[model samples]
Target: MKSTQLTSTVHLDYGLDTLFGRITKSAECQVGLEQVEHDPTRFALRVQPPIPQDLEQAKTVLVKVDGRRLNGIIRHTERLEDQSLKLEVEPE
Candidate 1:
């Protein structure tokens, strides 16, 4: 499998609403996507500003990228000095 290094504007869907019991908060930001190893469902995400502080490990989040909505869980997170957030996400 071939891996693509892509950086684009993506939507991050997180948090829950009491009324919907589903995703309620969304933020538009630039993100870098690189496939992890040979797995298409796993990715290393380098998220740029505006960086979100709510994202954490084991949190389920939806990322809308290039017209595809990817539902995945954050496996790990790292805070960069540049204020960008690095994340390892695995699609569930």
Candidate 2:
């Protein structure tokens, strides 16, 4: 499989609820999509680390793929021995 190297940004939303309701905590990281699977309905992005530390607390993750913005949640994340991160995302 061929992978596309592109500049992608990861948006992480921290769901923090306060007396005022949910507090919006967000962080953005400039990363690369190493192994990408694009389908008619969804995209599976294998993010090249090192992923932002803030992502550990992220409830929602949004990625900018191509010229389109795709929103998804982080289904799984693994830390490789090489210190890289592999993320399984399902587009919503």
Best by TM-score: 1
Alpha-carbon RMSD, each predicted model:
4.1, 4.3
The weakest ten consecutive residues by lDDT in model 1 span 15-24
lDDT of 2 by residue, 32-78 (tens): 45444454443445555656565554445566656657666656666
**Per-candidate clashes, comma-separated:** 0, 0
* lDDT accuracy of residue 23 in candidate 1: 56
Query: Model 2 — TM-score against the truth?
Result: 0.56
- Candidate 2 regions off by >4 Å? 6-24, 34-42, 48-50
> Which pairs of residues clash in candidate 1, taking residues 3 or more apart in a chain or in different chains?
none
Q: For each candidate, what is the lDDT?
A: 0.68, 0.55
**Compared with the true structure, what per-residue lDDT tens digits does model 1 show for residues 1-92?**
33345556677776543554655567787876666765656876777777765654326667766566777777777788988777778888
